[model samples]
Target: MKLQCEVEVINRMLPTFGMRNRGKGTRAVLSVGRQEGKRGAIYLMICTLKDKAGSRYKLENNIEQLFTKFLGEGKATIRLKEPALDICLSKAEMCSLKNFVSIVGLANKGSDAGTPLLSQLIPAKTSEIEKPRAKMFITSKKDYPITKNFPYSLEQLQVSYCKLARIDMRMLCLKKLQKLDLSNNHIKKLPKTIGDLICLQELILSHNYLESFEVALCNSTLSNSLKLLDLSENKIKALPVQICNFKELISLKIDENDLLQLPFTIGRLSKLRLISAAKNKLSCLPSTFKMLRLEKVDLFGNPFIQASPMVPDIQLKIPQTLLETAAREVARYRIPYGPQLIPATLCQDLSMAKTCDCGLSCLNSFIQIVVAMNLHQVSQTVVLVDTMGGTDAPIICYFCSLTCYSHFLDKYLQSIRD
Candidate 1:
């Protein structure tokens, strides 16, 4: 049986019949060659422009019209005997023989020595043709091929802008598939069986509505082989603690989510070099995060509060050089008040005030009065006041800042006078 082979002209050009434009004459040429056994055929149609006086030609159109024309023929080559010409016709049979001869003369000046026309017209073997996989584009449109779960096989699958309601791994059993993109879909969840795809290296799940990831993804089978995982633009509130299992993960993107905190187990992902969690609602991070060996981390738009020393220290020690640098950063700024003073009303309000008319001297006096009014030291005085009040004790203001310093002092003096 003769194996049918396809020779598509991915790029082509037609020679111009008229005079040179801007001193350059347009030319087109198709080069074809084959190996011992006819495994497959390759047809390269190049459209070039050469200065009327120059010997070299410049390539103009990279996508040749020949491929489009050949696709319509359902065959790679066409042979004709009436004219005693073994002519290879592409989908664009519009190529004129006179123009082709002119292009050949311009492209191959010396090859005119003895090669026959049929030899030049034959297509080359498939090995000579470069095959570039199509880019994967995930979309949310309902009519996309990936939405219907066709049993199709491809090196790269682009399903961008598709409204995918759900994903069932069993239906997509493409064994040779390498890159799978499901971005811009409305998928709310992923099947745990996704780990079955042992050969998958790149998985893009960005711009989806996923709330949580399947725990099965962290299985050793998937984690050890997976290289890049994009889970950006999701509604995930928290990442699975098992994510640390993906020791081989080179890049993990979870940006634009509702995550409040990172799991402490994240520190175990020592191999992770890049992690992006920007645009989230994180308020605090675990101190164990100090163990990460990340090259870059994106934590922008997350309300992060510095952790206190009371938090558990990371088991792994940061290099002394880094610690010294961090210490220098801390030494740059010093808070005047102790941590205990943070809850004081005067401290809270005055620290936040942009401008306070009260001069430095007045502020110093207020601070002194507050320091002197330690209510915890006068338990007996508090009990006597409570007993005299009978049914209910009068609310007493204890702190003596600028707001209450004069009133407390006047009341004490009036009691003595009475």
Candidate 2:
């Protein structure tokens, strides 16, 4: 088995000899396998790119003692007896480390007894075990090397407090990148291409100069992969309605912004469980806001409008336009449509179609009513919206037809009269 990790060779007799170590460690590939043409002989190899000639030891009877010391969080130490050395491995995943430990233990047994261990220990080519894969990288300005290059194998990267104005193009090319933290920067705008990181799950962009969450990003592949998003302490004025496209989003933080309102279709984010919009300009929530089953919600320090009983207005029926009729039919039946298959403007109109409480789509022409709703109905933990400790807030409800509006009005009036 070949494992990529940071390796440090500590001489067991160095302290006794009154000598101090010169360097910390080097990124290297560790290989454990049997040598070819030599039966029942297992060899352990450590190779670093900087040195073509690497250290090798025969595990069969070469060791007086062996120790596997697991330091929590993907770090371990392997001590060899005869060599009097400590092989420290860091950034090695748990599974890989376990496999290595098992192989070394089996080799130490030196018995041809159990199922033949030689078959499992296949010799690796020099080219195959040269480059170490760096999966996790965290760097700050203090220790970050100017000439250091980011490994393509990186899965998580954090470069906070760097004062970067824009994202590095090289970072975007990391296809396997899953978590990225670029907080406390001077970035003013985000490129839509950030959504191309399909494996990305958590994105931290708090404490920046960003003015808006790019609408194009909401329409990208992030709608499926992104789970947590942080945009706090930014200069953002508003978020696009399409922000709800992230169906996998569980935690959303947009605190300290100038948001006027949330998306009316925010309930479409079925997986969302936590949301914080504290210290914003929101006075009320969307009618569909009650659809969320959030665990925690914070809307503190907002100027929420006082709640009052809504009085329904009876009006004549308005004829729906041909575009609106088509949009409704498309939305109702869940027809597959997009800009690639239809006009972009038509697609936009379809996307903006509203849903009535009765579960019918309405476009352009629809009865609109604002009613007070208790925020506690959707969230278990809610921050008080007003100093009065009241949780009721107004929400705008839409209806596809007069009949639907009348149906809702009847229920509303009856509930109030109770």
In model 2, state the lDDT of residue 383: 84
Candidate 2, after superposition: displacement of residue 384 in Å?
1.6
Off by over 4 Å in 1: 1-143, 146-153, 168-171, 310-418
State the weakest 10-residue window (summed lDDT) of model 1.
355-364
Q: Measured by TM-score, how close is model 2 to the native structure?
A: 0.67
Top lDDT hit: 2
Writing each residue's lDDT as its tens digit, candidate 1 over 92-192 gives 22334333433333323333332333232233233222232234344446455544554333556767676776874633576546678888878998887
| lDDT score at residue 41, model 1, on the 0-100 scale | 25
> Which predicted model would earn the best TM-score?
2
Alpha carbon lDDT at 244, candidate 2? 85
